[model samples]
Target chain A: MAFGKDHELHQRRFGRNLWVGACLLGFVAIVFGLTVVKVTRDGPIEGFDHTVRPQMTEGAK
Target chain B: MTDTSILPPQSGEAGFGDYFALLKPRVMSLVVFTALVGLLVAPVPVHPMVAFASVLFIAIGAGASGALNMWWDADIDQIMKRTKGRPVPSGRVTPGEALQIGMWLSCFAVVMLLLSANPVAAGLLAFTIFFYAVVYTMWLKRWTPQNIVIGGAAGAFPPMIGWAVATGGVSVESVLMFALIFMWTPPHFWALALFMKSDYADAGVPMLTVTHGRRETRRQILIYTLILVPVALGTGLTSIGGPLYMAVALVLNLAFLKGAVDIWRRKEEEAEADGYAVEKKVFRLSLYYLFLHFGALLAQAVLRVYGIGGW
Candidate 1:
């Protein structure tokens, strides 16, 4: 069986789709890496959640 | 299944490159480089990953504003020969698409920056987007000849944001870096206006060349260049500066001042006869002026790692 050739328009669409996929993957990887670094590194993570926590209030005491 | 052969060809459809072009990658590059220098030169150390992520977000923020600028300026862009072929003006992308992309990316970049870096950097990035897209593009650009002089602030903020990323606040060094770009902007742009002929005039944008005439623009270029010399040299005395930086600053400033004086001294008839050679030369040197200054700073930073960069 012979395969049909892809048109220029189809090729362009494919290229665009590929870039979009790559960008999404890259963004995900960057976010994951940032999260890992932030969590594993040493310092007080100042996340706010309405409820008072001991570590957050330690300076006041 | 539909036959592939039956699908209609859309010749005008925009591809990924067109969308990327909408982001003004060239401007984004300046943003990335300056911001990276800002991040590295700070006294406080940043994690490699955090620094990378923060700069990436800053570039994205700069790009988002670029897209928005293209969207707003599409009308004038179509008129200006230099910008007539941009994505929106060329009919490759819709204004609505550009707007949505810019808005979405603007939010994403700011929020991501906050998560990856600090609030100060993120806040500055948000403010930069607003300043470029709204204050400069919408308001100042059409209204005054001093548009670029003031709009230059938007471009100057990246380094400051980078410094804030590392230090979580601004300082003299960062402010000097900001001032360097801010002061450099007028002379750089005015030189281009001197050379580029009627593009700005035809576009209805009130460039100094259009509003104040070429002579005044040249005089203004000299004035700004004079003001720029002190700021450029002042940066070399800051904590980020070293003997190497000071030498580089002195040499570069002399060349820059000479270029500005050459531009100021030329008559309109002389420029028109020689295709604005002096103005073009100054424009070319201006590119190196910024790059070398930043490169010297980065070199000083690297040398500091080995115990001998700054005074």
Candidate 2:
């Protein structure tokens, strides 16, 4: 039961897990950044939030 | 983290890099670069964040299709020298996992693209994935000698999709870019087939070389290169083109045509003696031929901002 060195398989698996975690974090950051830019842009805010927006409604213009 | 000594480690168990290898990163780099150029060269200016996200999604879609290809082509890949070491054929990644990853990423990329860009771009990206994965990899690859000719349309779509991301529709410029790639694909691939020897034949792939004789493949390469000259030069005459693009296209096309001619002229005896050196050189130049043309376009776009580009 004495632990000397980690097995090679475990190290590879660990590295894989770390990279997957990093990818997930990066994806989250991109989504967050996109949300900020999209909401703050010059035009009216349009999202799929279920409720109808006035600008999107027919005959509003 | 598990018990250290009991279970023997499984050989060929996949690592993260193996999964990434399933995506064919080299091909993805070409997709990213061409798509970026397509987006940047458009007349409409895109928001940096939106542009970045769109390109990323496009790349993901491309990677997904590549995974699908690796999954489906595993059998033939195991027979081909260059592809036998790929993730699926090498047994580092399972075919089932590759298919699952491909499908999931394809959906994710298309949905994210629709949200990030426009429906048109998303639709094109979806079609591209389908074309590459289902049409090219599944059907045409095994069934026809002209597989690469038609399958090339799958690769040629990215620039058009990139243009659609900015313009929300098609245009002559985008069509021209697509044509440039479509025409270039045959000659480029034929040159590789010439040098690759019998990989396609051994794999039962009906490449032009395997179906038609090598002389016919050589002749076809020259014909396609001849046709490609007009399309490549014609792009230089469009709005995306300028003096710089014309200059670069002229020089590059001449060199490419010369290489094609050299390939066509060399006899089989001399080629075998020299180890297809002329074909190899032509193949190398073809790589630079496409890149420099795209680079010149980007350069022209940049120069236009400085009042020195565009006629």
Candidate 3:
């Protein structure tokens, strides 16, 4: 909506828009990169254990 | 900055920081903190990366809602001194730009959240964005005196969203977290309404203080705060609760009740004479009240990590 306008606020917002978009994409990249690296057979990087089997309740079959 | 009172932003006036102002960073910070607490306190532990991603996207979703709120409320904002300096109202950013930012960010946050977390969590996040932007901002806000009461749901949904991100479904724990914010919202906002009387009146928003008299509003504040006490303390009885949380909740609720009582007993003339100092104090306490409650919840989670706290 503000593409054609050439005011200082508009220009400033446009510049910020680029930086914010870039930063968001960068964050996504970092997250996905970490996800892929952490999804290995060995398990996640921070030692988040997803390997525990659920213990059955008492009197189970 | 040159006055763009009748026109668009003046040339060479606003900076990049002005665009960030539209995000309502203060509100987003609260959402991030509470959502983090929710995720931390969940029964199911999540991957650290996933937890980070979920909180980040939820914060983005909050910012998106803020942008849209600024867009929709620009008119009322321009009328009220409290909001006159907002990006849209101040001519630092146009309404169209605000809408564009809001829509794009909302979609990005929801989609990224889906990628980072499960569908249930992402869906709730999407619904939260929609509720805050479309449901509350566009529909309910201008239409009813009960707006804050109902619209508070938009703010209340974060902890639920966080819990969903962790567990991939709703549960009583999550509902209680939602209830904590939902019930507290009325009194929290009504306190502000009591102090900032002219802002809503000038903006034509049907705040409790505007529709009902301040006496009734103060009475309602006491009533809601009375009700809010149990909900705050109720968390202590849940699995998330512990001795520390119970202790904190007990003292906070008593002090909060006293604050409400103090406000309830005051006459308008006395309030005006004191420059609404008591009202302002209560408003500040409300901020700390929520913050401390959530902080206690987070503390319980930390203790649980050491295998100590939580029943």
Candidate 4:
């Protein structure tokens, strides 16, 4: 019904693949976003530093 | 003669699905998981953004390696029933196109890793791609029976790359991660070759089973399993290895060794009658071995957040 019989057959056969492709594209976009963040940041982008000693990390900084 | 029309359209226009298959996403996933575990377990923590970028590039590099492998193995792939329908062999994508995609992605991944992490990590990622596509695929696979033994280094490099991303240097822990995978590959693969002997034979790939014969292949698997025990167990004493990973490695290795022993004791006639049950079981265990080990490492990383690990 979506694309008539001939096209629909191809569609069903490949339908799940479209979602996988979309997800991969989404993954690429997220990586690109993270890369931009890392490039622009003065320090590490997320800025949640882990270098502070364990005792110091326990409290709000 | 095979009917040209019934064959799955060798010259057909490539679709998005065909292109995705070039990445070998399942294999890329293992690369990502091991890389993630390596990153998380490092004493020097990575910024989330930096970590994400590093892993993403590593995955891209893995995909590039896969594409190049499919390109080179297209002939043998067509001969093997398991791989006959892959993008290059079934002909949804042309060999030339796969080569171009692989080359471009390899450069992009290495450069991106350099920008996001350090040159050490970038260098490792580049070496991994070179090892897999050039050393392993182009040369060793066809040339030797010890293909997986030597070529396994390509798969083993991801964690080292991940560790370098966090600390900008390799350490004992990272090396242990690398060794674990490197040691595991042969037995993992040979077990599959045990049951699917005909496939390797027809493809002329010179797998250990093809070159050394089954009895020798079985003995080699046991020998490698013995060597793997000390390597797998020793990782528990390192920075990333904690109580959980130690326990998990202990249990999995014992189970694996037991399985290898079971396979070693069986003959071809008995195996064939039971549908190669023992070899099939060992093959299934081998698939989970790396995942469970890496999963325990990740679990230890989480436990560290609650103030427990690495002791």
Candidate 5:
């Protein structure tokens, strides 16, 4: 019961702070996740721009 | 009480959490955000693994600075209500232990970054650690009301270091990012000082609110906010940002300026009578102000790849 009383007091004073902190952390995690997605999806674009091929001669055909 | 009794009893029972608290996670978060923005906006591409390593090492360096700051400020921190429960002051960690941890991490982070990235980033990281721990914490904090103004440079270096990691050098774009955070620090911190003046006074910290009084602190907050708007917008004008960033910057700066003006126009008596509502609002808005500005910069980077703006 004593522990409960202390916990309740802490919840009263810092509940909002804790909630906001969690929300901010969650938001950051989501943003980082999205960044990973974007990076992976666009990874080939740079390589595509730089890729080169050699042409075969008609004698080889 | 004699001087001997005034000292905390020496104990060597620090836990993991106590050591983590020494890192100042909140400050680390801001460093990580700005550094990530710098990495994203750099002209040269960095490998994903290398980018991750660079940011991690940068975060560790920021943590090292925080630990050193806590070690140096422990005396004042013990007297301040807001800081009384911190690991050092609460006796969870010894000042000597904190100093050792900070110095060790500072070396480790800088060396690891140098091996992973380049010497430019490592050197900047070393300077940032020294600036925050020595210049800001040891010197400026106890001496002047303009402490936060000059001390803010340490916090402003992350983005530049990040840019260096990617490009292996500094550029105008990174400097703009640095300016944005530097100019924003005063208003952001002074708004908090407006509400927490008594804490600084009790600790003999000589924050602006304690030295110049609340009215002047509020006015300075407004002045800094005015300066911050143009700097935030200027980031958009750089090669790193685009039209999307410009639009976001315009709207955010307008709202921020309005909030600053509201804080400025209110009389002290009115603010006190209203439970310091205006100061609290400004403080909360300042958090979102930085986040939104940086978030828009990241958005502009993404849009540029799609050919929306940065062509």
Candidate 6:
């Protein structure tokens, strides 16, 4: 199929193998990059501190 | 002349992909990425699901603007080689139908954003649609050589909208993001105009290259690029970026500035001697230049999660 052919043809040709490979590579890169930082770092990153407990109290002032 | 035997009429069938092409998926992807960066970098936290929905609606709104742009610019697009094969110009979609789709999607995306986010984000989304479809496409594009320079603001709004969605208001951070893209637009687009001067000339569009001259366009490209480098790096000095992002910005801006200088120093005759290949390379690099800058922002956001000082 040509580059700008219909969606189905695009899916059949580039979608299955090439698209999946590209996406998988992106995912792996992100995960690997994060893991590298996690291993070398001393503590949780500032912006991504998901472990910080949220205050449950309502505004009492 | 005698009447012939009855024959079957041809079907005017259009598919979903054709409709999708009208949305300008490449542009939408940039909108989505930049908007997501805005959301991620905001001081206030939003639920993950809500953030996802907000970005989705923003992407849809960008698509709506693209569709409307195609509908309005179909005449010029049909003549310009760069845009001649767009869905509307190629007869895959009718202008009326494209207009309907664009307007309907514009409303749908705005309402969805309003429901999921706040009114400020919704208002910005609406203004962006109106700016692109009416102000830029309808008024400025045909009138002036500086159309893309001023009109590029419409494309620069998504990150601000995303920041508004996360924080419920505007901030300097969002404005910096807006300014980065807004300043980058002229040099990035003018580089292409330098090489494709003939295309604009053929289509009778008054691009800077066609109206002023290639030398003037090259000078403008260098000036804007010089301005853009500082703005791009300034975003790194803000709360949304950190050391890593700053390093990337410095390197990228230096390279971009070098490219602009090379372009400025060359004459059109010198460039054209090699088929204007240098200008074309700069144009192609400009595309990646934006993507890499934004991609660095996304990387900074992820790094902030692991304590790399993004925030």
Best by lDDT: 1
lDDT of 1 by residue, B24-110 (tens): 999999999999999999999999999999999999999999999988888778777888788887778877788999999999999
lDDT of 3 by residue, B230-300 (tens): 88888899998999999999998998999999999999999999999999999899999999999999999
Q: Between 1 and 3, whose TM-score is larger? A: 1
* DockQ of candidate 1 against the true complex: 0.62
Candidates 4 and 5 compared by DockQ, better number: 4
Which parts of model 4 have CA positions greater than 4 angstroms off?
A1-32, A39-61, B1-10
Clashing pairs in 3: none
Model 4, global lDDT: 0.86
Question: Where does model 3 exceed 4 Å of error?
Answer: A1-25, A41-61, B1-15
Q: For residues B1-311, write the lDDT of model 5, one tens digit per residue.
A: 01223447654455456777899999898899989989988878877767887898899999999998888888878788888888888777778888898999999889978977899999999999999998888888888999999888999999999999999998888888888889888988888777764677677778887778778987898899888888888888888878888888898889889989988888989988998887888889888888888888888888777777773
Proportion of native contacts kept per candidate:
0.75, 0.70, 0.35, 0.20, 0.00, 0.00
Q: Give residue A16's error in model 6 in angstroms.
A: 22
Please state the CAPRI-style docking class of candidate 3. Answer: incorrect
lDDT of candidate 4 over B87-195, digit per residue (tens): 9889787787888999999999999899889999999999999999999998888889998898989999999999999999999999999999999999998898888
DockQ of each: 0.62, 0.58, 0.22, 0.17, 0.04, 0.04
Candidate 2 lands at a TM-score of 0.90
**Cand. 6 TM to true fold:** 0.79
Per-candidate local distance difference test: 0.91, 0.90, 0.85, 0.86, 0.82, 0.82
Q: What shift in Å separates residue B67 of candidate 5 from its native position after superposition?
A: 1.0
